[model samples]
Target: MTDDTLAEGKAADREKWKEKGVALRAFFYIFGTHVFAGFVWLLFYLGGHAQK
Candidate 1:
């Protein structure tokens, strides 16, 4: 294949991997935040009840 064609192919593959990485990072970030927040809220809710 020509140099330009090969370069384009490599670029396309790079973009595909980058998109996948971004999506995976976003998923972990959001999931972790929600999980942590849920635990924190649960702690507060339980603590308030314990004081009563």
Candidate 2:
């Protein structure tokens, strides 16, 4: 109703849309998981036993 309350609500809405979990948390989570998975697959692909 008041300007002060409106400002606070706007600030909280902005913070809620920050998406810190998706951007920061997921950056490390997906990045680490994919990177490790890729490394493991690379080893298998380039292993001593080839599919010639």
Error of model 1, residue 46, in angstroms: 0.8
Model 1 lDDT, residue 52, Cα:
53
**Per-prediction TM-score:** 0.90, 0.52
State residue 21's C-alpha deviation in candidate 1, in Å: 0.3
Off-target runs (Cα >4 Å) in candidate 2 are 20-36, 39-43
In model 1, the clashing pairs are none
lDDT of 1: 0.98
| Backbone clashes under 3 angstroms, per model | 0, 0
Instruction: Return the top candidate by lDDT.
Output: 1
Indicate the TM-score of model 2.
Answer: 0.52
Structure candidate 2, residue pairs in collision: none
Q: How much does candidate 1 score in TM-score?
A: 0.90
lDDT of 1 by residue, 1-52 (tens): 9999999999999999999999999999999999999999999999989955
